[model samples]
Target: MAYDVQSAKTWSPGDNAFYLIVEGTTQEEIKEYWEQLITDGEILQPLAPSQWSPLYGMLKHQFGVVWALSVLNDASPM
Candidate 1:
């Protein structure tokens, strides 16, 4: 599927408020993504177990877009 592209003023890295959410089925998968991000992008936060509810972590994409990745395990109440 194709989507429309909008033209706007370019923003500096970590300047925009928009972010992305990437969901996975396991912590390993999330870790893999984190590793890839570290190699290609930047790590906003290290890949560690979340202190709150379900297991999750946040990182910045290669294009400066923030990504909140999570593992939706069955053990999670949510």
Candidate 2:
């Protein structure tokens, strides 16, 4: 599957923070993307594949933005 940064926005101190959610079909694919993000960015939360679910993780982009990445399998709730 292909992915892209859909859009971006800025905020103030009191305003809500922004989070980009990336969904992928498989854990390997998402993990590869996560590694790329790590090479150029910083890891907020190390990649964790849930025992009860598929996968979930967080990272801070090089552009000073936060992103939540995940891989959803057929058994995933969302």
Candidate 3:
């Protein structure tokens, strides 16, 4: 996919690196961000329990920005 070429053309690594991997301290926080970004986007991966974290998911924004969201709990270290 040409995500790097599709999202905010003016944006640079200094801005967002084109791909966002948000690690929230709480499930609610990540979920909040997920719900908002996914409004007009696509859910590449549904949110669910993963070996790496309590919750994890992947999605692409309407404009082509890819997002990886998850909860950063004590049990996980990423």
Task: Give model 1's TM-score versus the native structure.
Answer: 0.60
* TM-score for each candidate, following the candidate numbering: 0.60, 0.66, 0.71
Highest-scoring model, TM-score: 3
Return model 3's CA RMSD, one decimal. Answer: 7.0
Instruction: For model 1, name the residue pairs that clash.
Output: none
What ranking of all candidate models by TM-score puts the best one first? Answer: 3, 2, 1
Q: Which one wins by lDDT: 1 or 3?
A: 3
lDDT winner between 2 and 3, please give it. Answer: 3
Off by over 4 Å in 1: 1-14, 52-54, 75-78
Tens digits of lDDT, candidate 2, 1-78: 223343464454332255677888888888888887766788877788775438888788787667778888787665
Off by over 4 Å in 3: 1-18
RMSD to the true structure for each prediction, in A, is: 6.8, 6.4, 7.0
lDDT of model 1, residue 21: 66
Candidate 1, 1-78: lDDT as tens digits: 111222474555445456666667877787887777755777676666675425577676677667778777666545
Model 1 lowest lDDT segment of ten: 1-10
Model 1 deviation from native, Cα RMSD in Å:
6.8
